[model samples]
Target: MAVATAALGLAAVLPGPASADPGSEVRISRTAYGVPHILARDFDGLGRGYGYAFAQDNVCELADQVVTQRGERSRWFGPDGNDGEGVNLASDAYYTGQRRAGTVERLLAREAPLGPTPELRRMVQGYADGYNRYLRETGVAHLPDPRCKGKPWARPITALDLWSVIHDVNRVSGTRQLVPEIGDARPPGTDTATSVSRVPGPARSADFGSNGWALGRDATRGGNAMVLANPHLPWADGALRFYQVHLTIPGTLDVSGAGLYGTPLVLIGHNKDVAWTHTASDAEHGSMYALELAAGDPTSYVVDGRTERMGRRTVPVTVRGADGRLTTVERTLYTSRFGPVLSTGWTTKTAYTYRDANADNLRSMNTWLAMGRASNLDELRTAQDTSQGNPWTYTLAADTSGDTYFTDASAVPHLTDAQLERCTLPGGPAEPDALDGSTSACAWGSDPDALVPGLYGPSHQPELTRADYVANSNNGPRYTNRDAPLTGFPGTYDTGDRLGLRAELGLRMIAERRDGSDGLGAPGFTAGTLRATMFGNRVLSAETGRDDLVALCRAHPVLEATDGRATDVRRACAVLARWDTRADTDSRGAALWGTYYDHLMESRSPDETGQGRALADAVRDFAAEGLPVDTKLGTLQKWAGVPLPGCDGGKGCFNVLEASPESGTGTPTAGAFGSSFLMAVELTPDGPRARTLLTYGQSANPASPHYADQTRLFSRKRWVTERFTAAEIAADPHLEVKTLRG
Candidate 1:
């Protein structure tokens, strides 16, 4: 492991914020659940404390992200290591290709207001230094966590490494998933072109999900603004996992909530005057370009009848083999004027390429910083409009002045509907997603209001401000509020009127709670009611489908599965008949419903042909696992020995918990991804009051006391009372303090 260059010493210091140079000193105060409250003089110092505390709980994951962004995964882990979507060799090639092309460096070199600001650059530098300082102090071999302790991959990182990872995260929904197709793309006669594993279509909406609601005075019980941020993300230890923190720079900036590991900003949090959260948006941030090849020349594409040779580059990636020997492999990767060439089953006559709007985007940190410092909804809107840095998420925010805001201000292409229609290739393989590359005019449209030329201006995108509320459950920006639907936006912005079941459920919950008709004793939402609404575990599908299912079960007591198995489902039917539809931990029949739904969907038949049989098979599968059909949801859906409540959002549960199936059975064994960092913030007379929870807990290390503490709380439908005020933080019984100096 390489020795860290930064020198930081940890010792006991005074409790107040520092006024010295940012790199000189900072203080980190840890409250219950290991949530860090960092105090510093400025942005750099805030990042320093943030980086140190983050490293204390998640050094291994941080190191892993740095390695991944540096295109060194194959070099350290292996060439065959799977990066969830593709093989490590391919992932390395894609990242290395971008590096060799000097893509990130060029973006970074851009002057401020478009690229990273000086403050953001300082924050990033301090974050890297603080991460390296922790490494230097702990000595990589003696690191506390066993995952990367004494591992060769646990090397200190630089600010550039952090920037690279930021670039990768900003493209989560874009070309990041096309690594295999990009890396394996070769000319028709090349040996690698035919073997490219075809990535199915555009990225699935399931890749990211969340429910964000900003409730204004009209909808809140106390006539104040309230916000509920429930992001559904993978629970695995990686870049997607959220880390809770409270960053303060005295009067300059103070915000609390959670950000993905390795980020320097409080991505979803609130200060005294404003609170904001994000939901995954389905707007197109990247687009496919179907290239027409020149006659008899696969490497040359025809643009408006002119032959243009594809730009070629050779990327060499280092791979560590089974014998611990390092070898370099060189791959010739091709690119077009649009972007990287992709091998999505392209023929000799035509090929595909993709352009990601966020490939060189480096403004998210600045945008988030501006939001944190914003005093009201107007300022927050200004932040989004000016920075244009939100990669692919809708921002939902509230202010003390009783205003609510929602916008899908993601970095979408500025292409107009007419251009999309005209540029769409006839019989294109990835239609609606792919455009004709034969004409240069089919390229991205320009908007004067856009910070970048190829993106839609803020005015052209959809946004809404309503006094009642604005809510999004991974839906388009049209129906943020039922009464005040935002329309007249370009089709590229996902202005569809139809809503998914999960999104429908989100709106229903907000409306029900607002009208006080959902039976929780509320005409308007309070912080407590907001919490209840989140974990109510209402299974919308069961509520809408269960009675009919019960009638069907009674009609067919005996059913035969397509697999030739038969079962008497009368007992299961009886249990479900009297069962509640909620997916609470103790709710019986929820597990049965989950399995039934999975099997029923897998059968692909909506009628009684395989539907009844699917139910029978679900029962049989449960019994085979020695579990009853009426087993509790928590009993089946668990992780790290903690019983997680809630069924899959696909099954229409507002409190989403998507789980994976047991081996060879439809029965769900453990949660896969959904409902990660959750927070309910209310702006009151005395600043903002909030309750938050990181469902998977703070530290990924099993030995850490905080590893499963919050997960247990989440299982019990509990939340950690957010200690935002200085006095509140000092009053915590489990509070621990540490100060670092350089």
Candidate 2:
């Protein structure tokens, strides 16, 4: 791959409208497992091929997302009244406010020095054109999926729609939660603002997160870098859908990995010389401000001792009636100097406003694009430092030079310690309502004219590099590496003092191997070692807490019997006593222990002592649900629509699998959110060798063969070989070729 110093200038030569014919220059070849290998002459052609391939697999999903982003869901498919369209009146109101805010238009116009650059602009345009072309070629009657074949929302999409989707993604984590408050600011009988008194804590939910690992030469058997990218995202919804593709612009770009729908760049993946992944970071990306409302007018607030009226905008929201007619309802939205004015419904005298780090950011794609083009770990770091577009994810990268890096690349609010101390109210800064906004002291101190104000410059963020290894399981930057701990960073960035079980497990795995006389007697990792560790079903809780639980059970074996529940409890103890600490499909005793552990964590009983009450409850619940005490873990925890044996372990386990309870049995064992996309890349002397598996398969269309192919493979702990090079792609016997054009 050739390194271009002025890589951003490559977009300047992108074919003009007359010469930029998609079908003439873009060739998409479907390799094994339905992965598209796109060969394009330039960035525009690459985008065209990407849009066509994505539409082929997820047209309906894409269409639905477009509809949601356009804020016309209610107009097209009635209010979210249990119609299965997944859009509600609140959604309509929120999206309408977003559109009326001019988020897309403003960002596009301002993104320049830090940019959705010319290259990105051309690529997005080409992608929109290609998506439209797909819709034109495959009429509604010929649509692949019958579920949304004739739906009016599945019509052609525009470039603006794509831009809006991107904007929505950036704001989803920040202001999306205030939709109801924005819609119901001045409800009848409510004259006060809502109280945002509760402070945000470290997210402990098992619903969404990721585990990323990078191994340098010192920790690897081949003296090469290795990376494991396991992002735990939703399996079904289009929200976190990750589409895999290999894009090549000859000498300009050659990168392959997974990205979400509607994005034109690969968010996580590897190029020839560098491989990278991301995990949610514990950084504050937004701030809440308490405004002192002026007397006699609720919508006017005092700033710098001057009464400033909040800007008011009425968004017309259209909702479809039961009879299919549309009715337009007007929703009043107010914005203060701080940002959107949220109706907190608090009786207190103060109003609240929220400002997000990426509120007007449109340069995230450009950053990812630059990272993809990087030739080394240093280059990747430079790309991140230059384009601070990443909103809230820590980046982990490994290069062929045997270097490993980890950084809180998320754009965080640059708040100084003095500012926080001076402006903090009685409550701590963690409390949403703690910031005193009457004066500019509590304000995010950034130049008002800057494109994205209050964001930390690259020098302010925390980063670490280790020749041995680096890993993060969504914990703060302080524990990126246990031995070489990142210290002295401000507490305002991350206040969590302890590491989660998953992070502990990841560190332990690396430390044990590094200390032991392993492969080549140097704690070196091989491809096989990494793969085994990822699939290893050892549950951390079982390993650490099982012996004590069994001892406690043996001591107080007898509980009050209710419908033979006492006998079931003894049986569960016996099963757990003889169980091996593993979460594989056929592991016995896993189900009982998993249930017991879950209840132990969730039990709110004040009368029960220690784990006894939780254990008894787990036994009683298991018996009541008609499941045997010694049921195999696989039988109780199955994936959707699959009859195969289930895997064990909950969130924080090395083999992480968090799930909801099965309807029939009250055991929380069914798979919900886990590692949907797993990619392991190893940098070699020849090039980069990769393997990946998507647990839910590639396409959302049920009729497609690729829909469940990888899911079956995932069930058996298997991975499909990632063909990166031209020769490797050509060697796939099942390859199918197509040429898409204008």
Most lDDT-accurate candidate: 1
Model 1 TM-score is 0.94
Candidate 2 lDDT: 0.74
* Tens-digit per-residue lDDT, 1-742, candidate 2: 2434233233332233423533246778899889998877677878888888888988888898888787777888787645333236656766777777776887788655565888888889888877887888898778898768887778888777888777666655566555555554552245343323334321222225788999999888779999999887766668677889999887789999998889888889999999999887777767777778887677788888998988888788888898988888776777888877665532235666777777777778878999999999889988877777786788999999999999987767767778777776563453344567788767876533333667776666788888888898877888888878888766656758688777777788777676653232445688877877787666777788888878877887865332334433577778889998777767888778777777777755423354776678778877778888787766665555442333332434766665566666534452356677789999987899898987777788888787868877766888889999878987899888887655
- What are the per-model numbers of colliding residue pairs? 0, 9
Distance from true position, residue 606, model 1, in Å?
3.0
lDDT of each model, Cα atoms only? 0.84, 0.74
RMSD of each: 4.4, 4.8
How far off is residue 485 in model 2, in Å? 0.7
- Writing each residue's lDDT as its tens digit, candidate 1 over 35-86 gives 9999876678777888889899989999998787778888998877754433
Clashing pairs in 1: none
